[model samples]
Target: MVEAVMLWNEPNNLSHWDFKIDPDWKKFAEMAIAAGKAIRSVNPELPIVLGGISPIDPNFIQLMGSHGILNAVDVVAIHGFPLDWNHWNVNEWPAKVDEIRAVTKLPVWISEVGASSFGAEEVQLFGLQRMSELLLGNVERIHWYSLFDLPASWTATTRHKEAEGSAYYRHYYMGLLREDETPKMAAAEFPEGLGICQWFHYEDHRLDSAVEWLHRLKVRYLRTGVSWADSHRENAELWFDRQMKALEPFNTTLTLCFTPEHLGIAPHYTSPPKDPNTFAEFAQWAVSRYAPAPVRTNSAYAMPEEMAAPSVLR
Candidate 1:
């Protein structure tokens, strides 16, 4: 059983080519509705969430509401960065929450909020402090943008050379740790006793110390990947069984993200599936393998009862 689903992400950021070319709110609303319906069909109790809109644009939320997107989702999520983006201000967050609430009347989550060091660790620390203070009671939850910084080499492969000079370049330094895995000032500045969650990229799964470090940090939840390319390979079920067994000791809720490379409309992992039915078939297989039911028809697949409901499909 999945708890919740967040459909799409940062739809308001037009820098991504897909949003720039197909910036149709109606089409986006339709897609969100269809995705929500499909998820609910699989697990009716699951809560469907609209992806965080960057900069907390209430006008966009109102537009989504006009197209019935608000009715389809159980929650509205927004992303904010007061220090990097001139369009947003820390002082204005409460009003932005009010604006969104007035339109959607749904629980709002600040799903991605963070500051980048950009060679100024002190400023980043101060920004995080202020962001936390401002958002304390304004939203249901605040999922800070990330847990680790991207390696410099990652930019060369994942982004265009021209992006090196853009505002988006700051993302490479947004993590609690520096690229070398050293703690930054922001890590020390994180508020005491507040629940924190981290996003772990699939590539980092092989790191020996990742889980231990997360446990030390008292992380309650982890948003990680379930790669379709890996699962479709031969003996994939055995591999996943071992992996899940290994992860059981950490005792963290897992939001398993699926990115099917072969089925994607574009070559990129984030692209939508070319055929929804194909993706659905893959999802069923994944659920049956990962859900907490001991060998349901397939003797090779089994998830401990403790592992079932805590793993959400996203």
Candidate 2:
């Protein structure tokens, strides 16, 4: 086929300039699989090559594994940029190390990536070789991201500019050759950007990570301006609403509200005169009194009140 026997899927690419970034890799991978299906329809026997610059999106891995397609790809690829996706659009790289290895249990490849830029030629080569060892040893099949001094237009550098024979500025000069495609000292050490090494041994996969992700929300997001009991209660409610999407995907809700015995308010509306400030204070009291009877961390975060007979709110 004009597109080659199989497609080189650049999951990380958007265009020559636009590189798509998906915060949720699983959903993004779903789309990728759908797209792959559409492509395969064009050439039934043709296999798909995934991971061109994809760099291991966890969400993507979950999607791929959930389906039975881990081995469906002809050549799996990796893009190891070694930074967060926000910085180098490659955050998924580190996290996806395991995912790629697992997927490569079938077939995997590295369509692109390299080492340090603006550093000596060896640094660039070293990064590529290091990642190559980890990936190659897993499945024994991969085409490294690249192997030559591609110009700045595609790779972004100017090693070719010195004219005084300074050898490493071709931006992606990981190839053991010159910009003219001539052989350099590194050319024969690796061939076609492919090599093999030991299977990866990452640090202990943290089990039941006790890392405190849900930090106690300080009263900081709650503006402590003019308020009474109601305001504090309402602030807690507001904070809950603001943070629910992050806190609860399985389930969550604002089940209660508070007021003084004489206020004659419902156990729901902590708004209007009853702003977030009042809500916070009310929540502090609620947790202090009726919070599940458990010794939660001394966190100053809770619902302004709990559901109970209207008289208890008083």
Candidate 3:
């Protein structure tokens, strides 16, 4: 029952991870939005969820909405992984959530969060801290990260056809459940995988993760117009350019949540912004202000149905 596929948290899903898109990276989102639309044309009320690329910041949300994602899903979600692969301190947690809000008006939820042990007590502290923040921040629900400790890292492999089998298994030890779905020592204390959990790292072993998700987005978008695929290519190009530029650090302080390998290339797409909150906020502003000025013509978004308010998932 993979009802939803979304991101975890800022700590777990970090920068080193890259997702590549075939043909082009930017168009990957267009595919998601497009599929959601087709699904909607039939059901008309299914809530499509989008994530697994959020936690870093809200720039992802802005990217999705501006690319026609807002109309695709019923609700948006994100992750908040806080530590590095080494379980080091990552001081920006709540700010990451702010980054999401900076872009779209969609209701949100905290998708993933956990702490791991790597000779640093502070690692677990972050999980406890985030749990407190969630409570204080009025978060409605939060599913703890690892229900068990694998003492190993998450799996890794290069799905990149270009990788030509260059990569191997990745080291990913973080999990709320053991391979058998049993609980780890930390998880045993809290069985449902809620209220906060701990992560175990597999410091060595293999490959990257995001590279696959991101690449899929890019390749799929170019091949198919998932969301706003049918949008005049001119409009998409123009919107993407303006939207990317607008998300720059100027007025707002949200972060820009793009990685270089979003499209499979080193310089594939947008890089991680120094201040994601500012960048994402500014980008949202740009999207709002840059709304295509109505020309005396029949544009794609001219129809009332086309202009309907977007939902969590269409």
Candidate 4:
């Protein structure tokens, strides 16, 4: 069952959001608020999560809060990669959680956090252990970056491919399994009950293998995405149905994100949509189709037959 729905991915990061066009994040905030409200309209009980912000910036959180974005969603999430991308030491995980918590009363979740085996598998092994120690009980949820390494054929999402050099390569090795489906050292001793962050592209071949691995790990929670951009592809609904069905066993957090190229103000996926309502309508349709609110008929509105026996004379 899908336990929650996230508005987007890392809206503050350059790779996921084109901040140059929306320097103040006002547009992103507007889009998120619309998406959150739409999700709630479908299933009021469903938890709506703000896209996990990358770099753990408190100022950005404050900005979202100022726009009343906080009121539209149930939880605030963040993404961090101390070993691979973050500048701070790994031990500061709790402090980072505190920083987000200080700004809002809503629950804080570590939507994505991981270490990459770019240089050595041992780095990922140690990262898993240390991350568990620091973050296991500190946050509401911790979804380790991925279950499978990104294929070498695909490019990592980044604005500057040349400047990102090592950081760009690290994206491929953040998974517990290699691109060939071989397990890394860290996969064997992975902590139980923790969430995993594994995004499946439209018709991605790794969906079955990822499900097997999640079951093997006794994972209870999963954080994945359904891209609005990919909705335009032929047979996209077929892939979406298959992916969601395959993952239905786990408690999932489905992130609805990415602007369709034509819908974007600019031609990029990171560009804000020309109409925020389009994104909201998509979110509403997804939730209503996939996870609708349960129906409950009130006694006052019950039919006469359902309430009591009808008189023959009547």
- Each prediction's RMSD over C-alphas, in Å, is 5.8, 24.7, 15.5, 6.9
Q: Give the TM-score of candidate 3.
A: 0.45
Best by lDDT: 4
Q: Tell me which of candidates 1 and 3 scores higher on TM-score.
A: 1
Q: Rank the candidates by TM-score, best first.
A: 4, 1, 3, 2
Give me the runs in candidate 4 sitting further than 4 Å from their true place: 299-314
Clashes of 4: 0
TM-score winner between candidates 3 and 4: 4
Task: Summarize candidate 2's per-residue lDDT along 1-314 as a digit string, tens digits.
Answer: 01112222333333210222333343334433553454343333444555344545545554556754454455555555552122443334444556766544545544444443335656555655565555545543443323334544443322234552433343344443444545444334453325211100012121111011112111011100111233344344343333332322211111122223233223221212112233333433332322222223664432223422112122
Prediction 4 global C-alpha lDDT: 0.87
Can you give the lDDT of residue 202 in candidate 2? 14
What is candidate 4's lDDT per residue for 59-107, written digit by digit as tens?
9899999988999999999999999888999999899999989999999
Q: What is the lDDT of residue 87 in candidate 4?
A: 93
Model 4 residue 107 CA deviation (Å) reads 0.4
Taking all chains together, each candidate's TM-score versus the true structure is 0.74, 0.40, 0.45, 0.94
The lDDT of model 1 is 0.60
Counting only residues 3 or more apart in sequence or on different chains, how many pairs clash (N, Cα, C under 3 Å) in candidate 1? 0
Candidate 2 structure lDDT:
0.35
